[model samples]
Target: MLWRPFGINETIPTTIGALTVLVAGIVPWMDVLNIFDIIRGASLTILSTIMMSIVLESIVFFGGLL
Candidate 1:
């Protein structure tokens, strides 16, 4: 329904439709690892940076320069 990739939004995701149809499924198919995969990688990198910050803060709290 989001995309009007047919004769002016005529085809629906149903068996009766001319186009390919899938009743109920995942939208962004994370299993295939597309854009979501890149987002996940970026998130992981951010989390690693947060961990590094926490470690540095802890070290400073314990009287360390780094």
Candidate 2:
């Protein structure tokens, strides 16, 4: 979404959405390998989930704010 259309704002909600999805995967892996504690992983998961929710809200509320 950032560069695909050439001028899409990289700082927009889509960025947060994509970043959270990536974190969802990376955090779990970090936890499984003992790089992150259970608490850290769980918190990160929650944060990512919340960010995803916010993306939906932004889409509905702003309606293609780009």
Candidate 3:
């Protein structure tokens, strides 16, 4: 019960195999790792800095300080 492209007699199994391995690898580590553990914190810190800088720049720009 495999739906394959026309003219190809053998079903393509490589794609299925690769996806299976990828999911299996990630499923085990999901609990031990999370975005807030590293990435989310860093990203939020960076975003806050950028936003503050923009606000400061706007004040300076409007005030003719720079």
Candidate 4:
């Protein structure tokens, strides 16, 4: 039997997509309004996703020890 963390499959793709968005936000190609807001939101999304993954993995690891 193979053991996989919950949402592992979805997490990778989501993180990748978020990173792509973040990069796009960083590039200043157009003089659009609220660009900073876009960058901030994307950064927050990436950070939260990473933090959530860490927490979930830790929980799974500790739970397995019990």
1-66 per-residue lDDT for model 3 (tens digits): 456667554535676765676688854555446634768778999999999989987888546633
User: What lDDT does model 1 reach?
Assistant: 0.62
Q: Which stretches of candidate 4 lie over 4 Å from their true place?
A: 1-35, 61-66
Q: How many residue pairs clash in each candidate?
A: 0, 0, 0, 0
Candidate 2 wrong stretches, greater than 4 Å:
1-36, 61-66
Q: So what's the TM-score on candidate 1?
A: 0.41
- In order of lDDT, best first, we have 4, 2, 3, 1
- Per-model lDDT: 0.62, 0.71, 0.70, 0.72
Better of 3 and 4 by TM-score: 3
Q: Residue-wise lDDT of candidate 4 within 1-66, one digit each (tens)? A: 264567367568678986787678864445334676569888899999999989988889546655
Rank by TM-score, highest first: 1, 3, 4, 2
Off by over 4 Å in 3: 1-33, 61-66
By TM-score, how accurate is candidate 3?
0.40
* Candidate 4 pairs with clashing backbones: none
Highest lDDT among the candidates is held by which one? 4
Position 23, candidate 4: lDDT: 74
